[model samples]
Target: MKKRVVITGIGAVTPLGNTMETTWNNVVKGNSGIAPLTRIDSENFQVKVAGEVKNFNPADYIDSKEARRMARFTHFAIAASKMAMNDAGLKVGDNLDGERTGVWIGSGIGGLDEFEEQHKRFLAKGPKRVSPFTIPMFIPDMASGRVSIELGAKGMNNCSVTACASGANSIGDAFRVVQNGITDVMIAGGTEASITEMTIAGFTNMTALSTNPDPTKASRPFDKNRDGFVIAEGAGIMILEELEHARSRGARIYGEIVGYGATGDAYHITTPAPNGEGGQRAMKLALQDANITTQQVDYINAHGTSTYYNDLYETQAIKKVFGDHAYRLAVSSTKSMTGHMLGAAGAVEAIFAILAIKEGMIPPTINYSTADEELDLNYIPNSCKETSVEVAMSNSLGFGGHNATLVFRKFN
Candidate 1:
């Protein structure tokens, strides 16, 4: 029998808050994190609002010298990892077997801020003006590498980069490592900090961001007014441990990871397949892996990025997979509040789903003024609800047609 995996600790740095408690509190309050762009000059841009993590001082987490060598994404990842490790009562350079504790983190794009600065320096001065840390700071895998090096985890160090699916894929992949006896404990999640001029311009040029100037109303997922997704930045990290290992050490278990499924649409790079075929397959696969039917799914944290295509197709996919049972499911898109975290979306939403099960409360999908007639379901609109969720699922669809689903069951 395969070993079971459980989430013992969690941490986050998002637009809603820099720490997990503050973020979760704001999320539960149905507060919007989206605001006017402060990270970059937005006076001349069509898309003026985004979800930016505020007041994050890099020197607070890493030394000045080390901080300069890492990208903003890596800095966020390491900072959150430290919180998660501390919450789990684990220590770097301490008693745990370094061979059994690993780190798996991911990012959609790494060090855009660093790359932009270095490129400017190189153009202004000469080639020697570019810092020697430029290459290491720019790579996507540096987040995982740096966290592992800092924490002294000698186990499987890896990164997942399936665009928006990066975070969930990384966490799911890390669970498999411990379930298969490759390790006993794993620190895993995803992070993103690509809020530079070029990054915003690229997404804006592609018409993928909502141009609505009102930050509070910009990211209305499932609402008819939703123009497009609002780009956001942050990191979400969770501690996954073998069930027996957690119990042996008296670790607090938040929830059990029951199943995971990842698939490729093979249809389009940016657009999802018609009617969410890839998303449906991912849900079905996750259910099969969990050895349960669609009727047992109590809630779903949807990949509702507020885009016209995603909200409609994802709703259709849920109905297709669950049929009438879909009506009984409480589906909410926390992106309504957190905005879309891009690569970090899945990890943050996974935490939202798990907390829903733990707290027995369904978070609200704010700003749901009008729902499409074709897409009808219990989306927990506008207000949070008190509900008993036994099993919850989180969905993430990424660019390049990658679709991933994860199921979390309340541990008995």
Candidate 2:
């Protein structure tokens, strides 16, 4: 028999707030986290706004000396991971079997800030001037490595790097580990802190980022006036445990991860496949994996990146997968408020989906002013809706044609 997997705890360091509770409260309120770009000097860039993690102090979670050695992204991951472990009431050597626990965290552009700083030092001074910890600090997989070390987890330590889908892919991959009985528990999620000069320049030149000066309305997903995605940074982590393991430990169950589907468009490097065929396949595969019909899906946390093609193609994918039932499902983009968190988007959005099931409240896609004729669906616009979301699906599509879908069902 296949083992069952469930989420026991979740933690987030988001642009809206430092903790998951605060972030969720603000998200439900339809508040925007985006503000004037503060991480980098905006005088030289057209993109003047971002969703930066405000008031974060790494010393709160890590030792002052140790925190200085790691990148800001790793700091967020460690803090969120610590919070998640505590929330799960899991102690590495006590309740949790250290040998049966693992960590899998993902990031798209990991430690870009650190890399830029160190490179400048090398260019201006000398190679000797570069920090020795630069390699460990800048690599994308260090988040998982550091989390495993901190938690003393001895099992598989892995990281997924599927651009924007990194977070969802990491969670999905970790879910499979527990489902396959490879491990009893897994700390999984994604983190990113890439709000730097080089990142802004690259995305700006590619025309992938929003140029809207108004921070409040910059990340307007599915809006007719939406131009591009607003770059953001943060981390989201979750504790996934086997159903029996959680039950035996008397852990608080948040939701069950019943299905995961991952696919590749193989069509475009950045833009989605025509008609979102890959995304359609992913959603269909997820529903099939969960053994559910399209009508059973109550909500979809869409991968609406606010980019014209992403919103349009993702909508087409939904319609293709659900057919007429797509119109009935509540689809919303939390990115409207949190901005596009790149690598962290999937994991954070997953938390929102699980929260909807736990709280019976569906979050809204704020800043939805003008509607498009072709993209018609119940977006739950402007305000939160109180409803029972028995089954929620979260989708994440990445730049390199990577598509991942996860289905969470209310634990019985």
Candidate 3:
């Protein structure tokens, strides 16, 4: 028999707030984290808004000297991992066996800020002037490496970089590790700090980012007037432990990770497969893996990126998977407020799904006004909803046609 896996702790540094509790509170109130882009000079760029993490002080979580050596995304990951470890009440080499603990963090684009800076320095000053730590700080897998070192987790340490699905895939991969009895505890999530000038310019040139000047109304997923996603930055980490291991330590359980499904579209580098065929398969596979019927799913945390193609195709995918039941299911995109966190999006949204199960409240898709004719579903728009969600699923569709789904059920 496969071992059951449960989420014992969660930590986040998001545009909504720097911590999980504060972020959840703001989300429940339908707060918008989008604001004027201050991370880069907006005057030179067409995109003017972003969901930037505010009031984040890395020194609060990492030593000043050590923090300086890592990239911003790594800082967010390390901080969130520490917070999750504290929340889980499992200390490596103390309450938990260090050899049985692991870390699997993902980032779609790791340390782009550092890469750009070093590239500039190399161009202006020469390669000899580049920082020696650039390689370690700029790679996508460094977040997991740093977390494992900091936490002293000696088990599996890995990362998944499937664009936006990176975080959800990391969690799903870690869940399987525990479920298969390979590890007792795993720290898994996603992080990204790619809000640099190059990233903004690149996304803007592709017209993948919203050009709306007003931050409050920029990210309106499923709305007819929605333009595109607002690029954002942050990290979200969760502690997943084997069920019996958690119960033995008297750890508080948040939700059970029952199923995970991942598939590749094998069709596009950026756009999703026509009608979301890949996503449909992912959701169906997740349901089959969970051993549940379509009617059993009460809520869906959508991968609504506010893009023209994503929202339409995702709606189609949900309809394809759930059929008539899709209309009855409550679906909302927390990205409507948090903006698109790139690699960190899936993991952060997964936390929202878990929270909905624990708190019995669904976060709203803010800025949703005019409805799109093609997309008709209960988006729980512009306002929070009080509902009892027993089984919730989070969908993450990434570039390169990666589709990942994770199903969470109320831990009975």
Candidate 4:
């Protein structure tokens, strides 16, 4: 028999807030995290706005010297991982088996800030001018490696680098490792910090980012006037444990991870497959994995990036998978509030999914004024709603045609 997997704790470093509680509160209130880009000189950039983590003081999470050695993304990942472990009621010196705990994390473009700075130094001075920490800061796997070293977790350490699908893929892979008896407890999720000159210029050139000046109206996913995703930076981490292990240790159970599905489009580099064939397959696979019917899923946190192609194709995928149930499901893109966290998007949205199951409330898709005729779904526009969600599905589609879906069930 397959071992049961359950989520025991959650943490987040998001644009709206640093902790999960604060972020969820703001999300339910339909608050916007998007704002004018202040970190960089945006005068020349076409996309002048973004969803930035406001007032984040790295000192609060790491030592001054240690903080300087790592990339900002690693700082976020370590901070979030610490919070998650504490939330799960696990102490550093506890009797838990060190070999039973592992770390699995993801990031789309890791340490972009470090790369840009070092490259500038190299050009101005010489190759030797680059910092010794450059290699550790730039690799995507360093996120998980740093977390494991910080916490002394040694069971299984891995990182998934599936573009925007990185987080969900990481979390799902961690769940599988524990479920398959490789580990009893796992620290799983994703983080990203790619808001840099090159990323912005490239995305702007590709016209993949929103140029809307007004922060609140910039990332209006599924809306008729939806333009494009607003680049954001953050991390979301969660604690996953075998059901029996958690229950035996008296751990606080948040929810159960019931299903996970991953696929590739094999169609396009950036755009989703026409009619969302990959997305539909992922959703169907998740439903089958969970042994649940379409109607059983009460909510769907869409990968609605506010891009025209993404929103439309996601809607098409939902219609194809859920059929009549699509109209009845409460689908919302919290990206409307947090913008897009790239690699961390899926993990953060999964946190929302668990919260919806626990609180019996569905977060709204803010700035949803006019609906598109081709895309019609109950998006819970502009306000939160109270409803019991037995099961929830969160989808993430990436630039490399990667499609990932995760299903969470309310813990009884």
- Is candidate 1 or 3 superior in TM-score? 3
172: Cα error in model 4, Å:
0.6
Clash count list over all predictions: 0, 0, 0, 0
lDDT of 1 at 3: 94
Residues 252-352, candidate 1: write the lDDT tens digits: 88899989999999999999999999999999998998887899999999999999999999999999999999998999999999888888999999999
Q: What local lDDT score does residue 65 receive in model 4, on the 0 to 100 scale?
A: 91
Count backbone overlaps in model 3: 0
Pairs clashing in candidate 4? none
Off by over 4 Å in 1: 92-95
Candidate rank order under lDDT: 3, 2, 4, 1
**Ten-residue stretch with the least lDDT total in model 3:** 89-98
TM-score, cand. 2 vs. native? 0.99
The residue-by-residue lDDT of candidate 4 on 124-176, one tens digit each, is: 99998899999998899998998888888989999999989999999999989
lDDT against the true structure, each candidate: 0.91, 0.95, 0.96, 0.93
**lDDT digits (tens) for residues 185-233 of candidate 3:** 9999999999999999988898999999999889999999999999999
- Winning candidate number (lDDT): 3
